[model samples]
Target: MAETEKSGNAFVETIKTIVYALLIAGVFRTIFFQPFWIPSGSMKETLLIGDFLFVNKVAYGYSYASCPSLRLQRFGIDVDAKDICGFFDGDNTRLFGGEPERGDVVVFRHPVSGRDYIKRLVGLPGDRVQMKAGVLNLNGRPVEVEDAGTFEEVMEPQGPQRIRPRCANGAVGDGGMCIKERQIETLPNDVQHTILNIGPQRVDDTGVYTVPEGHYFFIGDNRDNSLDSRVPAAANGVGFVPYENLIGRADRIMFSSAGRSMLFFWTWRGDRFFKAVQ
Candidate 1:
């Protein structure tokens, strides 16, 4: 009986050690290096639904890069609560880094409902941003378009049948197919990036907006199909994120999976591993 008790105790101790190690690893991952899984088509060609991305939480600043431009002094500290839901304590954590550059990919808390989203920076404070004929214009420069190619998007089937959009015989932007091949280049500051255009019409193109100080103007690369700053703050979209909502920067794409669901790991798209974010 004595020998059996010793063996049981040994097994328990071994299990305890393993559990503790795993718990610590989880803490490190969630705090510093979190693995973000793409769940929607908002980031289309750049990031697929099953693509798992690793975000560098320390790139911009602390957990919440709430500080103003790395140009201005950081916000300093949290003195009051914000939002009715109490989502975040509004702790104005500051940092001494440079402001987010034009082409940097950022993650921030949505202003309307406090949800988190990933998007590319398009306009800085005091800059004019507009989307006309499906092309994003900064200040006065028209973003150039390039045909990168097509992608198979798996989305919810459209609603009931209705009068289809009239098709004119010409290039897409000129008026042709519904969701055809289209691309454009947006020059934010001096950095340029590829933007996919599905069509020439979008409801988000309300009008020109001048990004206010202490806030940033953002939009998704998949212009034709993303809910972003274009929507008013009253509509539940991010309405010019304040420095307090800045999360971090997407430094790289760790891995991506194609058609297959995230459940099947053995069939992951091995070719996408270690691809740098452009």
Candidate 2:
């Protein structure tokens, strides 16, 4: 019996240690650093397929951190509205912290698919956004595009067979999908970086998407390659992102590797360090 009692005590202590460690990690991930992986090429050139990044959790606003832990009043009655359970069990939002700024790289829930997407917020609420001849435009003004020099071969397209190939989801592409490679483009600053561009095969295009209030319109830096707010998602594209759907902000690339090759820490990137987000 004594042996069993000692074993029980050990198990309980182990559980407590684990719980404490998890709590600490969660706190760090929430207030300081959160890790995310690049899933799609939508934000290519800025972020790549295998690139792993860290987001600033406090950059946007508090998620669950904003909630009051306990009622402050001594003799207060419980309010039903404050106690109402939401769609997802624990996640709840009372109010927002900060609004996303122009040129800020952000991660938000997709309006159509309800998935997370990292995009550069080009247009904001009450902004007249227009895309013409590969140039972005604000209210009667061009959104400024500069000619940054060149970058190394970064993103690799699927392959020649993918051209006109039924998209991964079997969405038919305009025969001869597109041939793309590395090229240079002017970033927000005069700093140049290699961006992806497709030749003569834009599958989607639209006109004058007026960003509604409490929402934002986003597009990929790879203009011709991305199926962003321009194309219809019912077919396959991001529409408009509401303010409430925001997750957090993509602040910096913590690390980069050639493949899943994370074993060799030396092989990790040293150049693409703390770059001010685009």
Candidate 3:
């Protein structure tokens, strides 16, 4: 009888230890950093579809979305506390130092849909932004851009259907099809980043957009394919992202896989392992 009691106590102790460990891990993830997997080619070349990255939660300080109290509603736990944790100009935790700068690749919550979106900061507060024939123009001046080369990636099958190497950039003939033209872009802050100029998409030409106060403009490295600030939120684009919606900056690629899902370990991209997100 004593032996049975001892064994039961030991099992209870083991379960308690696991529960404590999980609670600690959850707290850490909610406060300092968060892991995100890229599921789309919106930020391709810079961030591939299968890339896994850690967002620096302390980079821009904490916000309402970063607070655990805000997430309680989902678990049937209600907290009447106001949403005022993460703010730059207002009172905030100020855990770290840094603000979003032009050319910085960041991850933020979509203003309308509340979905997480990643893109490069292109327009700062009060900056005039526009695009002319696929070339980016800021503050009445055209941004500098130079041709890099071509980029090609396989479009894997969806479910049981197979995909062919169709023209991705809307190019004619067999030569210009199935590949995207790369270009090196220099932002106003002198931050250089790569952009994919695939085809003459609708956003290739747009009217002047004067960024309002406390808002920033973002665009994708894949110019023609991304639905970013150039498009309105009502139209399914991110629209002008508010400062409070900012989450964190993407620092590096933790891991990468080319498979449709992570279960396909055979499709792991070994070369992109631990690659710095430039």
Candidate 4:
């Protein structure tokens, strides 16, 4: 009887420890940082498909969007951020809010789909943004973009999604060399970053978009492959994201994996560990 009681006590202690650990982790994620996994090539060379980073929640202060949304299809658990902190939304305000500067890479909730998206903030409130002839135009001036050779990669299934990359060098067989024209784009704020172009697309030329108050404009580093503020939300694009939807800014990549699973230690990208996000 004594042995059984000891084993029961140990089990109870273990469960309590797990519960306390989970609560601490939850508070950390909600208040300070949020773990974000790069699941797409939209940001491309700047933020790859397998990059893992922690978003600094305190960067833009707190809002309803700061609350984590738990969605696990396999577990049948689907909880939206609004479900947890919906009352804090709708006013277009934040707690201890700070304005996000142009050219910062940020993660936010999609206004329509409620999915989290990471993109480079390009247009601020009251800014006129447009894409004319493959060049980004801000306030009627074309942003500087200089050719920087080509970005090359192997043509193969990437990450768990198995999504193949779109190449400027046309269709490529598996394991073949894939290429995209690379350019160094300088935002108005003087922040420079690499952008990949895959020839011309409809989004390359768009009418002027006047960013509304309390909203922001974002775009992907992979210009031709992204459906961002260049398209409207109704058309399956990001459109103008509201300020309250802003979650946090991604400062640096904690680690990166080039394989389908992070457990595949052999597929880790050593150089990208602790790499600063440009």
Candidate 5:
């Protein structure tokens, strides 16, 4: 009887230990850092579709929005009087922190949808932003871009052909036919990064956008592909993101997988492990 009692006690103790460990981990994750997975190819070469990265919570300080524990209290503005969750409306305060600088890749809450979004900070408050024929113009000055060579993606095999060509010029000229224009773009602050131009898309040219106060303009490195601040909010694009919705900056990639399934060990991208997000 004593032996059985002791065994039961040991099991209870083990469960208690696990619960405590989980609580500690949850608190740490809520306060200091959060993990995010890249769900799309918007950032492209800078951040791949299968990349997993860490967002430093302390980078912009703590806010009601930053704590997962307080998610229920995070309110949103009513898009229309008929919308659900329209009753709750107010702004959360961000305590102690600085604003994001140009070229910093950040994660924030979408203004309308309340979904999380990650993009590069291109324009600050009160900066004039425009894209004229694939070129980015900030405050009336054009950003400098230099050719950085071609960026190619291997097309999925269809039937007998193992590798298919999908170049920029046509349907299939050569194995490396469908090429994207890659260039090194330097921001006004001297922060340099690579951007991809996939020909003249809808957002390649845009009218002048004067950024309002307390809001920032964001864009993706995949210029021709991203639906960023260039697109209007009415069109389902992220408009000028407010300061209150700011989350944190992505510091580095923790791990990456070429294949979406994590169960496949062979699909692990060893090269991107611990790679810093520039």
Candidate 6:
């Protein structure tokens, strides 16, 4: 009886410890930073698939989108951020809000689908944004863009989604080289980042988009592949995201793996560990 009691006591203590640890982690994620995993190639060379980073939630202050949305499909758990903090949404306000600067890489909730998307914030409230012949035009001025050779990667399934990359050099077989034209684009704020282009896309030339007040426009680094503000939300694209939907800024990549699973130690990219997001 005594041995059984000791074992039960140990089990109870272990459970208590786990509960406390989980609570602390939850609070940390909610208040300070949120872990974001790059699951797509939209950001391409800048933020590749399987890159893991912690978003600085305090950068833009707290909003409904700041709350973590836990969705474990296998476990049948689907807790949306709106479900946790829906009361704080729809006001277009944030507590201790700070304006996001143009050219900053941000993670925001989609205005219509409520899905999280990471992109470079290119248009602020009331800014006129347009893409003219594969170039970014801001307020009637074309942003400076310089050809920077090419970006190459193996043509194979990427991440867990098994999504293959589009190549400027046409379709290539598995393990073949996939190439995309690379360019260094300089924003009005003087922030420079590398952007990839596969070819001329439908969104390459678009009419001017006037960003609405309390909303922002964003675009992906992979110009041709991104379905960002260039397309309307009703058309399955991420339209102008509201200010309240701003989650945080991704400042650095904590870890990166080139394999399907992070547990595959052999696939880790050592150079990207703790790398700052440019």
The model with the greatest TM-score is 4
lDDT of 3 at 185: 93
Residues 1-278, candidate 4: write the lDDT tens digits. 99999999999999999999999999999999999999999999999989999999999999999999999999999999999999998999999999999999999999899999999999999999999889999999999999999999999999989989999999899999999999999998899999999998999999999999999999999998887888999999999999999999999999999999999999999999999999
- Per-candidate clashes come to 3, 2, 2, 0, 6, 0
Across 1-278, the per-residue lDDT of candidate 3 in tens digits comes to 99999999999999999999988976786677878888666787798777899888777876655643333455886532134443332432234535788888898878766667899999998999999999999999999999888887644441112223334555344434368888999987888888886678889999999998878899999887788999989988888987767778898899887766777889888999998887
Q: Rate the local accuracy (lDDT) of all candidates.
A: 0.63, 0.59, 0.77, 0.95, 0.78, 0.94
Task: Give the TM-score (vs. native) of candidate 1.
Answer: 0.72
Q: Is candidate 2 or candidate 4 better by TM-score?
A: 4
Pairs that collide in candidate 3 are 62-86, 63-86
Between candidates 2 and 6, the one scoring higher on TM-score is 6
Candidate with more favorable, higher lDDT: 4 or 5: 4
Q: In candidate 5, where is summed lDDT lowest over 10 consecutive residues? A: 80-89
Residue 206 lDDT in candidate 5 = 87
Give the top-scoring candidate (lDDT). Answer: 4
What lDDT is reached at residue 222 by model 2?
A: 70
- Write one digit per residue (lDDT tens) for candidate 2, span 1-278: 99999999999999999999988976676566667766666676788655677776566675433221223256684432123322322333425468777766777656655556777777788877776666666776664455553333322233212222112222333433333444554434343444555443453334777877777878777766676766656667877766656667887787665444466566566676665555
lDDT of candidate 1 over 173-238, digit per residue (tens): 322344435354647455656666555655536688889886788888777667888877887666
Candidate 2, pairs of clashing residues:
148-186, 164-177
lDDT of 2 at 58: 66
In candidate 4, what residue range of length 10 has the lowest lDDT sum?
223-232
Candidate 1, superposed: residue stretches over 4 Å from native = 1-19, 64-88, 91-98, 147-179, 265-267
TM-score of each: 0.72, 0.71, 0.83, 0.98, 0.84, 0.97
